[model samples]
Target: MKKKVSLGFKLPAGMKPPEAFELVSSEGADDPAAYLAHLEDSQVEGIVTGMGRRFDVSLISKLPARIKIIATASVGFDHIDVKAAAARGIAVTNTPDVLTDATADMTMLLILNVSRRMREYLELMKEGWGKSLGFEGMLGFDPAGKYLGIVGMGRIGQAVAARARAFGINIAYHNRHRLPPEKEGDAHYFSSLEEMLPHCKILSLNAPATAETKELLNKRTIALLPKGAIVVNVARGDLINEEDLIEALANGHLGGAGLDVFKNEPHFNRRLAEFPNVFLTPHAASATVETRTGIAKRAFENVARVLSGEAPRDLVQAP
Candidate 1:
C-alpha cells in the first residue's frame, strides 16, 4: 500500500501529484493560518508547500503528528524554519538546480535593463517619443569590457558569469571558498567583498539569505562601489538594505538598479516605484512555464521519496 500526502496548493500545469497521495484543501492554500487549520483534522502523512506560506516554529508546532515531511517548491528555503522541523522529526526539502538557469537568465536581464536604462526608454516610447532625443540625453553605460563582481559563486552565480563572459565582461567573484581553475574559467576570485567592490562597475547579488548574508549590501558597502556603478539582484530581497539602495539610486551614486525581489514582497518599497532609474520586477525571476513545472515536479518527487521510506534528494539542513 502507498502512503498518502497532501498538497498545500495546486501544482503547475504538466505536473501531477504522486498517484499514492491524497490531496487536501484549505480555505486558502497560500495562507499559513488556513494550512494549520486544515492540518488539525487531516490524516495526511506529508504536506507540500511553497514560499508563499510561513513554516515557522509556531505553525510547525500545529502540524499534524502524522505529517512526516514538507517539500517547498522553490530554491530558497529561508522562509521555512528548518531547525524546528528537524526537532519535530519532520523532514524538509527544497527544489534547487532546476531554477538555476532560469534565475541566472533573469539576473542578466536585470543587468541589461539597468545598464541601458531600458525602463526609462520604454516609458518614453509608450508616452510617444515625439521630442527630438539628444545624443547626450539619457546616455547609459555599455557592459562590455566592464567589471562584474558577483557576491556569491554558487550554481546560479557561475551560470551568470558564463553568460556575462560572452558579452566581454570581466568576472570577479567573492565566495566562502574559491573554485578550482577549471570551474572558474577566466574569472578572478576575491576572498573579501570590501576588496572587490571598488573594481566592480556592475555588482550582482546571488548569495542565499542567512544571518550572515541578510542586509549584506547597505550604505557603507554601497559607498565602496565605483561612482555611478550599476546594481542588480535576483537573490532574496533581504540581501540588500532597501533604504540604502534607494538613497544611492536617488543621489546618482549608483548609476541605476534592477531588482526582481524586495524585502517586503507584493508590498515592496513604494519609494522605488518613483525612481525612473530603478527597474523592478514583481519577484518572477523563475516564472517561466518550463521552470515552474520543473519546480513542481521536483517538490512532488521529494514528497514521494520520503513517503516511500527513502531519503529525499533535496533535503534541507537545519540552521
Candidate 2:
C-alpha cells in the first residue's frame, strides 16, 4: 500500500494540483481547523505546502507520530517554528533561491513608487488631472544623489543595491557580518544599526524573519532616522511596528514608506493606507506567476527529499 500524506496549502486555484501525493487542501475546508483535525486523526506521513502557522506543533497537541516531514510553499519559516518541529524529530523545510530576484524587484518597485509619488500620478490621471504635463504637480525625489541604507546585505538586499547604483545611490548597509569586497564592495558596511540609520535618505529592509529582527524598526530606531527619510520593507512584516511607522509618517518626521509586507497580513493597517506619502503592496513581492510556480515546484521537490530521509538541502532546522 502506498503511503498517504496530507498536504495543507493555500495556493491559487490556477496552480496545478500535485499528482504524486494524496492531498488535503484549503479549497475544500470550512476552516483550517477542520482540516487539521482530519490530518491528526489519520495515521500517515504529512506533506504540506502554503502552510503558514496553520499546524504549529503545539496546536497539534498529540501530533501524528508517523508524520516525518513538513514543508511550506513560503520561503520564510518564521510562521513555522523550526525549533519546535526539530524537537519532535520532524524535518521542516522552506523554499529559497527561486524568489530572491522577484522579491528584490518588488522592493525596488516600492522604492520607486514611494519616492517618485508614482501612485499619486496614477490617481491624478484617474481623477482627470492628467491632461496637462505641468510643473505644478508633485515634485519627486531622484534617487541618484541619495544615501540608501539597507538593513540586511543578503542576496536580495545586494540585488537592490546593485540597481540603486545605476541611480547613483551611495549605499551603506548594516548586517551581522560584512559582505566580502567581492560580494558587495559598493556598499560600505556598518556593524551597528545606529551608525547606518542616520545617513539614509532611503532605507530598505531585506533581512530574514527571526526573533532578533522582530520590530527591528521600533520607535527608538525610527527616531534615529534623519527628517524626510523614506523607508521600504519587502522582507518581513513584523520587522516594523506598524503603529510607530504610521505615527512617524503622520507627524511628518519620516518622509514616506513603501511596504510590501505588514505586521498583520491580509489585514489592513488602516492608518498607513490613508497617507499620501505611503505606498503599500499586498505581500506580493514574489507573486509573479513564474516565481510562484517555481517556489511551489522547488518546495514540492524538497518535501520529497525530506520524506525520503535524505538531508533536505534547504532544511531550516538543525536549530
Candidate 3:
C-alpha cells in the first residue's frame, strides 16, 4: 500500500508529488464537502494547502486520525490554527524564505507606484492621454532621501530595506527586538511604533497578523505620521483599519496608499478603489512564477518530511 497526501491547491505546471506518496485530488476550498471527504480517506497522511481556506479549531477537530501534518504553501500561517492542530497531535508547517525576495520586490513596487502616483498616470495613459500637464500639474513626491519606517524587521523587512536603500530612501524600523548591527545596517531602530511614526514620510507594514499586531495601524497610529505620507502594506491586511485609513485619505491626511492585502480579501471595500491615490493588488506580492513554484515545492517537501517520521524544516507547531 502507498502513503497518500491530499493537495488543497492547484500545483504549478510540471510540478508533481513526491514519488513516495500517492496523490489525492479534491475540489479543495472550492467545494468544502468534497475536500473534507477526501481528507477522511484512511491512507491520506498529510495535506498541502494554501491561504484560500481557514483551518479553525472546528475544522481541525474534524480532521481524520491519519492526517499527521498540514503544510501551507504560503509563508503566513494565520489561516490555520496551529494550536488546534497541535492539540490533535498533527504537525503544522509553512513555506517561508522562498517568497521573501518576490514579496519584498512587490513592497518596493507599491512604494514607488504610490509615491509617483502611478495609478492615476497609468489610468490616464489607458484612457488616452487627453491633456498635457504643466510642471506642477500632477506632481508627486520623490522617495529619494525620504524616511521609510518599516513596522517589522524580519526577512521581508530587511529585504525591503536593502531595495529601498538603492533608491536613496533612509530606513527606520520598529521591531519587538532590534537586529544586530550588521543586519540593522544604518537604519534607525525604534522600540515603540508610536515614537517612530512621526518621522516617517513613507510607512511600510511588513509585520505578521497576531493578537498584538492586528489593527496596528488604526486612526490614532495613522495620525502619528507626518501629513502627506505614503503608506504601503505587503504584509497582513488586518494590520490596518481600512475605515480609518479611508478617512485619513479622504481628509487629505495621507497622500496615498499602496495595498496588496486587505482585511477582507477578495471582498475589500469598493471605496478603496474610488481613491485615485490608492493602488491595490489582489494579494499578489508573491505571485511570481518562480516564487509560486518554489513555495509549492517547499510545501511538498515539508509534507514529505513529516510523513517520513522526520521533523519539518519550517515547523510552526509540532505534536
Candidate 4:
C-alpha cells in the first residue's frame, strides 16, 4: 500500500498548484470535487495550506480523525483557531522568523511611499520629465527625527524600529507590557494608543488580526492621530477600516497610507486603489523567494515532526 498525505491547501489566486503534493490538487485540475472526497479516504494523514479564512474555526473540529497536524504557510497564524487544535491534541505550526527581515523592509518601503508620495510623483514622470515650474515638485517628508508609533512590538516591529533608529527616527510603542528601558533602549513606551497617537508622525499597526483588533482604526481612533500623519499596515487586513482610511486621506485629515495587506484581499478596495496618496500591494510583505521557500520548509518540517511523534520545533501548541 502506498502512504498518502491529504492536504487542504488554498491555491494562490492564479498560480498552478505546486508539484510538492502526491495526492494531486484540485487547483487547475479537471475535477474540483475529487479533492473534497479525501474525507472518505483512509490513507490521508496530514494537511497543509496557505494563509486564508476558508478553513473556519469550526471546520477544524470536523477534520478526519486521522489528521494529526495542520500547518499554515504563513508567518501569521491568526486565521487558524489555535485553541481548537490544541484541544484535539492536533498540533498547529506557522512559518516565522524567516520573513522578519523582508517584512521589515516592506515597512520602510511603505514609509517612503506614504511620506513622500511616490505614486503621485511617478505620475509626474509619465507626464514628461523635467517640466518643473516651482521648487516644490513632489514633497515627501524625511524620516529623520520623526516620531514612530508601533502598535505591536513583536519581531517584525522590532526590526522596523531598528532601521528607523539608523535614520534618527524617535520610536515609541504600545504593548500589553513594557520592555525594560535597557532592552527598549532609546524607544519609548506608551500605555495607551491615545497617549501615543498624538505624538507620532507615522503610526504603524503591526498587530495580528483578532476579534478585538478588527476595524481598530475606525474614525474615532484615526482622530487621535496628529494631523498630516502618515500610516502603515503590513499586518493582518482586518486591523483597519478601509472606508475610514480613505475618507481621512481624501479629506486631508491624514497625510497618506501604505498598505501591503487589505481587509478584502484579491478583491481590493477600489477607492483606496485609486488614491494617489495611498500605496498598495497584494499582500507581498513576505513574498521573497528565499522567505517563501523557508516558510514552506518550516511548514513541512513541522508536519514531519508531528508524524514522528516528536514535538515540532516551532509548535504553537503543546502535544
Give per-residue CA lDDT, model 1, range 280-303, as digits (tens).
999989999899889878988888
Clash-forming residue pairs, model 4? 116-140
lDDT (Cα, 0-100) at 41 in candidate 1: 66
As for model 4, its CA RMSD to the true structure in angstroms is 3.7
Query: What clash pairs does model 3 have?
Result: none
Every candidate's CA RMSD: 1.5, 2.3, 1.6, 3.7
TM-score, model 3 to reference: 0.96
For candidate 4, write residues 1-319 as lDDT tens digits: 3334555454434444334444433243223234345544535666666765455556777776787877888877776788887888778888878888999999999998788788988877898867674787667789888999999888888899998898889999987778877668889899887888989999888887767778888899999998999899999889998889988989988998999998777677888878788888889988876777677667777777777778887777532
lDDT of candidates 1 onward, in order: 0.88, 0.80, 0.91, 0.78
Candidates ranked by lDDT:
3, 1, 2, 4
Off by over 4 Å in 1: 1-3, 27-33
Order by TM-score, highest first: 3, 1, 2, 4
Return the TM-score for each candidate structure: 0.96, 0.91, 0.96, 0.88
Query: For model 3, what is the error of residue 136's alpha carbon versus the real structure, in angstroms, after optimal superposition?
Result: 1.2
For model 2, what is the alpha-carbon lDDT of residue 92? 78
By TM-score, is 2 or 4 better?
2
Candidate 2 lDDT over 1-319, as tens digits, reads: 4456666555555888656555655345445576666666654576665634455666444566777777777777777766777888887788878888898889889888988998888788889983776786588888888889999888788888888887788999999999988987768889999988999999999998777899999899999999999999998888999889988988999989999888777786788889988888888998888898888777777766766668876787644
lDDT: which candidate is best?
Answer: 3
Winning candidate number (TM-score): 3
- Indicate the worst ten consecutive residues by lDDT in candidate 2: 21-30
How far in Å is the alpha carbon of 233 misplaced in model 4? 0.3
